[model samples]
Target: MDPVTCAGLRFAYGASPVVCEVDLTVRESEMFALLGTNGAGKTTVMELVLGHRRPSGGTVRLFGRDPFRDRRRLASEVGVVLQDSGCALDLTVAETIRLWLRLYRRGEVARAAAGLLADVDLEHRAALRVRQLSGGERRRLDLAVALCGRPRLLLLDEPTSGLDPQARERTWDLLRDRRREGTTIVFTTHYLEEAEQTADRIAIMDRGRVALTGPVDLAASFRRIIEERIG
Candidate 1:
């Protein structure tokens, strides 16, 4: 079975539907990207996958078990980096990572977080307070924390938000390295370039439904888009 699978997944807040029936599959050691505009229900889909939101219909499975019902087991395997996450403002970066280590008796969480920060070139700021970090730096810190759990499945919701071009490239490289180490990655992003760079496959959503889903190779798709633009 794929590491993650969803079939006919639907969600709504009250009577208002946010995500329409969606089907997706994610495999181990592969990077999958979800792309869409603002309010396109990308976050809702992710929440359902993470078990933070219950599906109104259909099924979501992580390693062939129901995601919402097996959340505790899923937690041991899933590492997450969300777009907006809270960090104690007074905590230094190292301290923050160590505290996260305490949450799981994961012996190497601190070392892992530090290694990830170093890999992302944030090692120099390791002692800085959360409130003192720049927007990009804070985003990197979030990713570092996500890695602390040493997860098999990494779910990143807009992982590169606020990063500069160079930082974004570096983050892409880091993800590539992680995938090489056999981690399954599922992430959301609006940037086509980021998707093409980091994803093995792309699922594009529009108006609460998937508009396109395929391998990320832009060779033909970009040509079609550019030809239309030129015409």
Candidate 2:
């Protein structure tokens, strides 16, 4: 079964519906990108998949099990990095990673903490407090924390948003390595080029519905489709 599967998924906040009849499937080791404009319900989909919000209609499954009902067990297999996550400002980068490791407890977190920081180019800031880091540096720190458990499914929201060119490229390379290691990744990004360069399959959402879904080879066409939808 696909790690993530949603069929006819629907949701609403009171009188207004946000997601309407969305169907998507993310295969194992696939780098799936969800692209959309502001208020297009992309973030809502992420919340649903992570079981942070319940679906009002249809179904969402992770590894063939209902995500909401099986969330406890699924936690071990899923890693998520949201756009803005709260971390103790006083905690150093290394301290934060070690603390996250305590949650999963799969193995030696101390040994892996250094590597995680290095992977995101935060090794130089390992001893620096979280509050002392720049916006781009904090984003990288969030990534490092999400990767602590080597989860099978990774969900990232605007992961490289504030990063510089070199940092962005490094983040891209890290994703490539994760994909090679059989990690299924799902991400939402406003940057079309990031999606075009990394995603195997891309889904573009507009006004709570999927406007375009296709292979990256056809990304040029998808770009036009997104523009038309926005216009």
Best by lDDT: 2
lDDT of 2: 0.89
Give one digit per residue, the lDDT tens place, for model 2 in 1-231. Answer: 799999999999997999999999999999999998889999999999989889999999999988888889998899889877678899998899999988779477777887888889888998999999999999999888888877999999888889999999999899999999999999998878788899999998889998888897786675676667754
Q: Which stretches of candidate 1 lie over 4 Å from their true place?
A: 108-110, 218-231
> What is candidate 1's lDDT per residue for 1-231, written digit by digit as tens?
799899999999999998998999987799999987888889999989999888999899999888788898888788888768677989998888878776756777656767767976888998999999999999888888887777899999999999999998888888888899999999998777678777998888876787677788852375465223222
The TM-score of predicted model 1 comes to 0.91
**Which segments of candidate 2 are over 4 A away from where they belong?**
none
lDDT of every predicted structure (CA atoms):
0.84, 0.89
Query: How far does residue 207 in candidate 2 sit from its true spot (Å)?
Result: 0.8
